[model samples]
Target chain A: MTMRSNRIGLLTALLLASTGMPAYAGEQAVIIDNFAFQPAQLTVDAGTTVVWTNRDDIPHTVASGDSTLRSPPLDTGDVFRFAFTQKGTYRYFCTLHPHMQGTVIVR
Target chain B: MLDVSEGRRDALKCMLWGGAGVLWTVAGGVPKSRVLAPAMADETGDGNFSFVQISDSHIGFAKSPNMDTPGTLRAAMDQVRRVRDSARLLIHTGDVSHLSHDAQFDTAAQIIGEAGLETHYVPGEHDVLVDDGKNFFARFASGAPHGGWYSFDHRGVHFIALNNVQNLKAGGLGNLGAEQLEWLERDLRGRSASTPIVVLAHVPLWTVSQEWGWGTADASLALTYLRRFGSVTVLNGHIHQVMQKVEGSVAFHTARSTAFPQPAPGAAASPGPIKDVPAGKLRSLLGVTAVRRVQASTRLAIIDTPLGG
Candidate 1:
């Protein structure tokens, strides 16, 4: 019975590892549209991955406030993902169009 | 028509005569010889290689600061001609019109042409409003493939006109785009690094302020190409203010507007007309810069003189 239980535990661990699941399964998404960012502000836990999808026809990008973090320009159907490792309110915007703005709050 | 008394008529005539005499005195009397002599001296000094920088003309504007839009533009043109020296070039830095209207462009062209000099232009955000810069490209795309960015050699100095307002960002630095970046890289490939490069564009390459719409999108990429050149002078005109920055081998300068002046960054509620000044002081608020490359070194001395100075 102990041998059978150990096999079952190993199988469960392997399954979890293969799935690539985060510890808390925390992730978020934001959309860019019509010269503006939908849900312009978001709050997520530390280590959460935030994905920005460009729904507008034109190109856009997410650049950090101090201009440190920059995503490649995203056309329609393009997406950019950034993992929030630090805890702070980070404001970003489309470098191609300055009026479009969004914020990612990691805590 | 004869409602007034003879005495009142006589007084009015006397007043008119007195006013005409004062006007004559102001125009043609006294030591007016001194003013004319100095003007002649200025003309002599201006005979050298000089150019006029008219930035952010913003024609077709219907604001209170200048309701008669064309009139104010004509006033600016008068100022241009008053100080314009023979054999000078006219460099317009962008925003020649407000809405990219054909009529506005025509008017601007007429007024600028009246200065009677070779005019070079770069498009502004207002100029690229229609057809993905079709109008602006059609009008000012000399030797440039894309939205009117090109380089030319003139009088031992290199002049590069770049377009940055087409694909712009809100509060971000201007961009030269990838294609233009590639072209710029290739264009500068054969040129010597010691060439004095004067880069003119619509938006400032340097970061003026991120909160307000005073910066460009991807200016760093273009700057990377420019870093190889010695004495790189980057001139832009979006902010409509006189701001200068010098960063190790590059000097960035922005000229004042030929139209109305916007408020200083972070000073007003938003970027618009800054009121509360006396009426006669309006012209002093706006002006241009005269840049001259001194001999021997790659250094340029710029004089920012206010309008009617």
Candidate 2:
């Protein structure tokens, strides 16, 4: 039942991430697939929150290139959300597969 | 435009789902695979000079293909034990655990320790998930000092354990880092060119698949130091499948995972465990033997035996 229960929980989370039912004004999303970050660069407001969803079957981590942000290992359909509190450009990459990189330009 | 097939992309993918350790022989710059070990075992005369190379154990993995990782690893150890009587030792290429948990490491050590051979290990990206591989090095490479990268001589063979899973730059593949490279240069500065060298790292030194990040970024610089050696064998893991290539005096080989199997390079949409393999056919699909002959009086053989088969 652990696998089944976990799957159900994950499915619910995926629905929430994809549907964006409660999406606020300053929230964005980034998807990970094929060992690359979709939306290589994303521009969001200073107070906006960015949620990274891993669609790839493998696990990946959203880590700051300069060690500012670090996300736990996100499995398939898992999500990691971070809020950009300041106005600056932030670069992040997957710690597991560092080649998958993305940037967030906060205005 | 004409519709094409996926089979023609890379010819090597034909031998895709190889598992376990393998036997390798380098004769006149060409690598060959053999089964019988006694032919060259007589040349070395150092008791049993053959060692086993195991990779990608992935202990915490409990999905698809096979759910019981420990069971399969036990069977692999049994297979190693079958040849252990005539084996020099065992070398693990890495991916010892699926998630780098202390319990995962404990389970991996408890099972792999049953082999009773002084096993040499390198850290796969998976193993370093916890405390930058502190748990893994604490178990196998405690003497490595800092980076879990070290080298030693065994039976005239200079064996190097390199950590390519760390210092990985964004948009880059596995990296040896400038520090490890400098260490390697100094480590080989006073060595003889005639010596036989075996390199163990978690990631493949050669670029097996660029899109998948299956290769190392700074491997070329490290290869320059090794190119001078008369005979060099590089063993790696993290790809979860067997792939081999030979260049000049160097032969690079990747072994199978005792836990699960991954798709061939570009054979699927992405790289991960091949979850759809038929239930019982899992082990055999992951078992492929590689054999090699060394003309430098090394006479070393590696057997990749998946005991379940």
Q: Which candidate wins on TM-score?
A: 2
Instruction: Kindly state the number of residue pairs that clash in model 2.
Output: 14
lDDT of 1: 0.63
lDDT string, candidate 2, B43-108, tens digits: 323353567777888778765555567766776676666666656678889988877888888998
Docking class of 2: acceptable
Kindly list the per-residue Cα lDDT of model 1 for residues B133-232, writing each as its tens digit: 6877787665577557888876555788888876554455566788887878887888887776778898888777676657766778888888877667
> Which CAPRI quality tier does the interface of model 1 achieve?
incorrect
TM of chain B vs. native, candidate 1: 0.75
- Residue B24 shift from truth in candidate 2, angstroms: 5.9
Error of 2 at B226 (Å): 1.0
TM-score of chain A of 1: 0.74
Instruction: Give the runs in model 1 whose Cα sits over 4 Å from its true position.
Output: A1-97, A100-107, B1-47, B169-171, B279-309
Top lDDT: which candidate number? 2
lDDT of 2 at B175: 90
